[model samples]
Target: MSPTLLVMLIMMAVPVAMVFVYSTLSNVVMERDPEFVGIENYLTLFGDEIFRKALGQTAIFTVTSVTLHLLIGLGFAMMLNSGLLPRLAAALFRVIYILPWVFTASIVVILWQLLLNPNGVINYLLEAASLIDSKVEWFSNPSLALGTVIFINVWAGYPFIMISLLAGLQGIPGDLYEAAEIDGAGWRARFFNITIPQLFPILLAVAMLDFIWNLQQFPIIWLATGGGPLNATETIATFTYNLAFSKHEFAMASASGVVLFVVSAIVALFYVRHQKARD
Candidate 1:
């Protein structure tokens, strides 16, 4: 425990401490020395409309993406375990499903950018099929940007949730399912009574984990949209990163980082408590 604690300190504590201190200073693009600014940085963030919008968009992205991930993951996991396909077929499909996850976020962004382009394969097919009369701007349209990014995220993310749920499904006691079968339980009954109940903990855990990961998602949106088309898909991560690297507002970026930390910490604590209760 002591060694593990030391590792955590090295990994999380030092950087977090640095950020906290940095957040207190007035560090801007042309400043030679950072001046202590107290709580002004945090206060400025709250009053900033762009920051507020980013928060709202972040909320929408995180909620929508995580919900889709869970639903799609559960569906795929059930299908994989249903024995509809032979073992070889199921195994092959499982590999196929996980292929998106094997690719890096940069790869995901570039491939999707091409697919979602106005004259790309998707729109080309749609137009040829007479689905739409015109090209649809995916990232360029403010109304569609966030949703487009969210869809891409879901496409790349569902495989992980599916794999996790599948692993959890394998741990359920077969005897319980057999007993349910003997009791004349239908598929629906067995799923609700046996499968869901046994899988609840894993589902809850993965939901929380997904929420946390989605909260910090940057590359998928950044590489693809860069929070573009009037900042429609702007998120906390992109906001903070742009401040630090592009705008060189170190203090404000650090302040945003601290806010993110607090929110994540609250969620993590809730998850830990929930896990303990389940245990």
Candidate 2:
């Protein structure tokens, strides 16, 4: 094989092969071996309340974070593209917005952890401003823990969406806006009728990608709250990690992973079909 072909086979083909082999082995090993129980691992996963809760939490986190990120990112992109700001000012804002995308997830998590500490700089500033009498336990409160993680995900992920939107915005022809203005269309009417229609494909693509990415986000939640405060923030990715590493249930972990993969694939397929129909 050619060198590039060899590399592709090694990098992509081998991992896919490994997954199939491992999944098949999981079934066979469980059945033939006395210690292994066939399909019991999979059954246990379905019957487990913790896993179900984790799935639900993951869904909520994915939907909320992706939706907010898309909305905020697109808004920022529109602001940047408005041409009201000076060239230098717009360039600076774009650079600042892009900073989060360049940083690694671990670094972002650590920085936010310190910022969120009870006695950290955030609380200190709030207290100095008399915002409250005491520091709030950002991660310790179950109600806030998952929401905080979702907020962090949005912060870290929005830059990519912003960049995508900016690209899409630039591609929109000035003639469309000019024609709308000639027709005496208001700004809101022009935006909704022209700009949004042109941007729909880009927005849909970004939303689908964000959904998949957020669904599998682990480091932010793991490092932030470790899915704590009574497992309120627990997600499928974190749950699978705990099952494999903490509980040492490799078979069950594989089963959970398969479930996640199937769900993600189904959602992706639906999104793709919808996008195709729209196109």
**Number of the predicted model whose lDDT against the real structure is largest:** 1
- TM-score for all models, in order of appearance: 0.93, 0.88
Off by over 4 Å in 2: 1-38, 128-131, 270-279
Task: Show model 1 residue runs off by greater than 4 Å.
Answer: 1-8, 28-30
Tens digit of per-residue lDDT, candidate 2, span 1-279: 599899988997676555444443444333555243556677778798988899899999999999998888999999999989999999999999889888888999888889988889998999999997899888898988988888888889999999999999999999999999999999999999988999998898888988888898999999888888799999999998997788766666777777788787877997889778877
* Candidate 2 CA-lDDT value: 0.85
lDDT of each: 0.92, 0.85
Q: Model 2 clash pairs?
A: none
Which candidate number has the best TM-score? 1
Q: Give the Å error, residue 198, model 2.
A: 0.4
Compared to the true structure, candidate 1 yields what TM-score?
A: 0.93
lDDT of 2 at 149: 89
